[model samples]
Target: MIVSRTALLETLSAVQDTVSQLIGDLNESEIKDIEDYLGRICRHLRCSRNALVSINKLPSEILGYIFQFIHADFASPSRSWIEVSYVCRHWRRVALSMPSLWSVVDLRQKGFDVHKLEAFVQRSKAAPLTVFYQNPPSDHLVLRALQDVVARNMYRVRHMHVKADVCPPFSDVILSEPAPSLCSLSLWHKGPAFPLLHANSARALFDGRAPLLRKMTISACALWYVYRITSLTHLALYNSEAHWFGDSFVDMLDGCQQLEMLFIVSPHLRLATEVEQQHSNRIVTLPRLHLFYIVRVVCKCYPLPWLRHLLAHLEIPEYCDFRVEFWMTDREVVPEGSILSIFPPPAQFHPLEQVATVKLLTTSTSKSCIAVHSKTLFIVAHGDAFPLGLPNDFLCPIARIVIVNNTETTSFLLWRTLLSTTTHLKTLDVFEKYLDTVEFIQLLCPDLGAEGVSPVRCPGLQTVNWACLSYPDVDLLFGLMAMANDRAHCGSPMRAISIWPSVNGEDKRTVEFDSLGAPMGYFTRESTDEDCPCLHVVEGLIAAATPKRPDEDGW
Candidate 1:
């Protein structure tokens, strides 16, 4: 898999050439590589030959059903489901017969020229067309073909995603005709595609005939006129252009009463906060909304006032998944308490317990997730720097917490503030990256006699199934032992401590506490690299509850 590209290509050429000619062109080292390549290819061919009969035994109907799963998103230029047509005569016939197979067209593939696209359209027949065109080149011929092959078929188009830089004429022609079957429309104006598509032009989209439109996504420009359709269930509005969301943003949500999911991404909320209190008498009620996600990038406005202003006008349900993220790649530090505005008040979505579960997620790209059930709301954060802490007013009753580590070096103060929020924390799970195991144990260790030391954080913290470790060292074991003993000295006891090998093998360190909150005996796992489970670790952590402690002690 790691062979050089040149060597691979040379070997391939040698296989295609005559043996006499291949030997003449190669040195001793090259000859050995050629033989190895030939042997591998021969094995591959033999395996394919042996399995060909059984695979071909499948009926055409089943084969077609299998082919349906292979869509345009899964295919690229070098390889594609279209390759099935060249396998044999029967396969080609089956592939050509299915109109639905050609419905989803990806116009980005270099091989799919105007003629091939036209052929696919003819095969698709009356099937509802789903077209994806991204980064269109500045070529007259290709643009003309796209306008003709796709823009002309507006009536039958169901889903259209166009991310390109086009003059007004092409953008206008895309939805010039009346579309009765249009359901989903996504337009991302990346490179100065006539910003906002002109207010007047967007208002007359689909010739005012699109009734079944339910989902619409507009980025780089906000098409505020889409509220004309009443059937919209999912709406996503992302505007990077400055001065876009004037004052009608809340008014726009108020118009569509059936929205189930709402996603918005902007540099900052451009709403007039004075409108925050002005709309107190008149609230926008989205009764069907389940998920509300908002992202702010290159933040220009303070998050607290703007977010609170937006939420004050909306009526959220009791049980909804709300996520607010700050993506300030500009490396500007956010204010200390601005994060508290991320959560809506209990009056908006009054939960039964009034408590929330929190999750903080950070990937290679400095993203943190915090989830809250009810009273104390937490969420997944998308921030450039994780400097701020979960302030007191942010949320309360944090019975659950999840911390997924990636590349960014998290601050000790931020982690301290996070764990200090709740005392009844049942579990603390972390995925290893930059944060060292020694550093984590240091956080749990009590700063008993230090000057002006804060109280112990998450004293009642329980089951911890550690996911990342550089290696099993004497320092790590000593730190774990210290964490157990120090926390016990603080009066609130800790629970089962599970340690994973430097690689990956479950190592449980169940520490039993006496009545007075002190560790009696605990389990520790010692292993060499060979003893550890041979697993390749990757990024991302799954949200899971810490396993319950068994009746017996360390095993």
Candidate 2:
């Protein structure tokens, strides 16, 4: 069924040309239909090409290569490659004949036919499989099919990700013959733990013999079950219900020497409780760790000292909602009267060379929050509130600062910090709402500064992006325009300033301007014959803000 190479190329060329033409004409419905057709044609072509060749004709090495290309992780089912078999007979044969490609079967979809499921399991040819069940099966037929597939491939499964939407039927298959090749396992329950699979049943899956197992994730399970994973490298436990105390959780960590990445998402356990006191033993060693993320539901005491012992680098997002405890390592904590302390001992030890970026994100439900700190010097604060104050000496050699969701006061403070203090600052981006404040405009052109000293002074300043500007906010626009004009008048000149207006109701085609005239630095705006100079000024600001790459240096 494979078409000639020439025919395939011709089809591809035609499809590309058709798509390009459709793009030129902005008819969305027609474009979508054409895209669908193109996808079908591409799938069909792949199927046809795969079917034409015999297995023996291709070398075993080449066959393995083909298998690698086809074998996919079923975790992402929405990908187009999943439909390889549906293209044509040739593709179906190639796909079916390749056992490695069929190995990982995801049964998360509801109402999956048992017969087809069984056939897929059989076709996988003993290669390791990962069965995912996201939704509950409506009938016993689908359940039976799943049981049969698991039973048959019990020895071949490398990973089993189960999200039990309904109570599992505890048949012989549940109790018998655990998967020997299961190297990774994840279980997620919708509500509470099902009583049928008791602690013993949960323990049966590990049974002490998965030496190859490196990763395990469990949700809403007893802490005792986690003790069985002695060889884990990556472990994640979410909402391990209230009954499972933190002592057992700490005890479980004692055995996992190889554990590297530990993620505890939404642990309902409290830190101040007696259970935490009972497990005061520290994890003294975890040399191989590079990354750790903890998202706690309830406020917990600073676990930083313990984490410092384990990891070299960490990424904790602002919304994690946990307070950190700072415990100094024996080597780091300074002793009184020590000669070495004269140079001002480092207060805290961070393995990284510098704190790169800090982002203050504002959420709808919560107050303005300090969210992220990357190793690169970029600060982006978005909120109606002022960012928490930092000491003048707290050095952050930043290159760019982006402020979004700002009220007038927040905007004023931000401008003060950037214009007066932050010497390394380069680019400043203020959204329209922030610039609307008259106070912010006054701060930008502060009168208290040395006579004739421009309030906005960033020697390294390159670009400014002012978005959503309007007629009401024209004063703020004039201030920036004045700065640009002054800079141009001086020997040293600023690179660019870009402005995007809040064009809502007024017709863009018929907009007019009075005799105030276009500013000196304003770029020419594109307009139908009736557009004004104000629009031209806005366009000029935009042109200045656009960044230029090194490759385009001359241009």
Candidate 3:
């Protein structure tokens, strides 16, 4: 039945009286137990009634905030705030008139009606819009509905996300008119070829001035069409061969003075042909560029000398590489110095100490060891490049280390060194084959009189995420937890230790965890998934083991 606010409040008052009368006959302890149970019901009813009444009397601005909160929280398209509009006449008008609530339209559900989508767009009024299209490849109706919305209020769209197997063809109807309000555009095509759009059309779309176009991402496109995008602050081009047209790509960046973050993935970095190299003396300069990432490209050498030249002009502090092409030229190799020379000196314009995270994917041979520092380092080693002696100053300010290798000996050596040094290390994540050795467990908790170092040295370590896929040992697992408990009283308290049986899968069985005190929690084959349960155990153990003051006690 459709109930008014007055009627709902009257019903809640009656329910409250009944609960009070029932508790009147109970003793002190019984009444105290029932207090929590009855209080929840009263609070729920009161909130619902208050929301209904406030929908009629609250200021329009205040009502708009509540509606926006509800819209953002209800991400599912099937579960909308329209139910509030159905509550009563006044609520229906308030909800329908609040254009902000309808600004974000998510059309991800399968078999979503195009007409309903059109209705939603209309209800959004003239407010800036965000549209997410996540439908199947064959769902042409969804595309048609999106086209309809764009055609009507293309100027009002501020952000757009399209996730489909194949992007709908970009025609004059979709691109001829400029979307002046469009600031961010993310298009994901999970299919093979790029969407059908003329090169001229693509160029025209970006050639126009978009002062607020700060971020853009385009993945897996066919042709190389780069335009002058003047206002772009961040740009990402993935799985596209734009490097063949390097001149146009450089021209695009030359236009954007405020560009900061740039990512180019698996790009076909075409070298300058003999004719172009001889004729062109133009040097492209990106003065404002800071963070640049290059990944999985097939170029034999660093393709963009322009990028290196630009970095020489700026003050960058962090750098990363994934399958980058490092040229082995005679002049590039340093004789007796160190592998650290491979990295460019911190901007002479700025101080080297400002540098923070330096990550690389390389073989851990004696040569690569020179790059290791006391700062934050994330290394993914490959092949026989394991078990090398690391520097004593290794992990000086290192906070996190993730080692992904299959060598047991190398893993043991690295783990021992980390347990011995790295005084400030907070998280140690060891993956796959590294945890298979039986001796590593002994190293975790050395004998009292043994000359070897013990886990007690890593007093500041709070979390350990160890995944041992093969040869899982229950005894060694408990022993490690016992060691953590013994040392928790000293240093920063050890809150959680998560042990994953293997990298391929998790053991979720109900394992006994009573042996380890305050800071320890265990989960086996029956408990939960690997990473999630480990995170939960960490939080729970930290809360349980942390010391509290008298005034910090709960009510």
lDDT of 1 at 328: 52
**Where is the poorest 10-residue window by lDDT in model 1?**
536-545
lDDT tens readout by residue for model 2, 36-102: 9878987877766665667635665664466566456757645344466665564556667777676
Q: Report, for every candidate in turn, its global Cα lDDT versus the true structure.
A: 0.61, 0.50, 0.54
Q: Give the residue spans of candidate 2 off by over 4 A.
A: 1-71, 76-94, 165-178, 193-197, 201-205, 223-226, 239-245, 268-279, 296-407, 411-555
Count steric clashes of candidate 1: 19
Across 277-309, the per-residue lDDT of candidate 1 in tens digits comes to: 334445778888888877664443344554555
Q: What lDDT is reached at residue 34 by model 1?
A: 68
Q: Considering lDDT, which of the candidate structures 1 and 2 is the better prediction for this target?
A: 1
In Å, residue 500's CA in model 3 sits off its true spot by 31
- Per-residue lDDT value at 150 in model 1: 64
State the local distance difference test value for candidate 2: 0.50
**Winning candidate number (TM-score):** 1
- Cα lDDT over the full model 1: 0.61
* lDDT of model 1, residue 50: 44
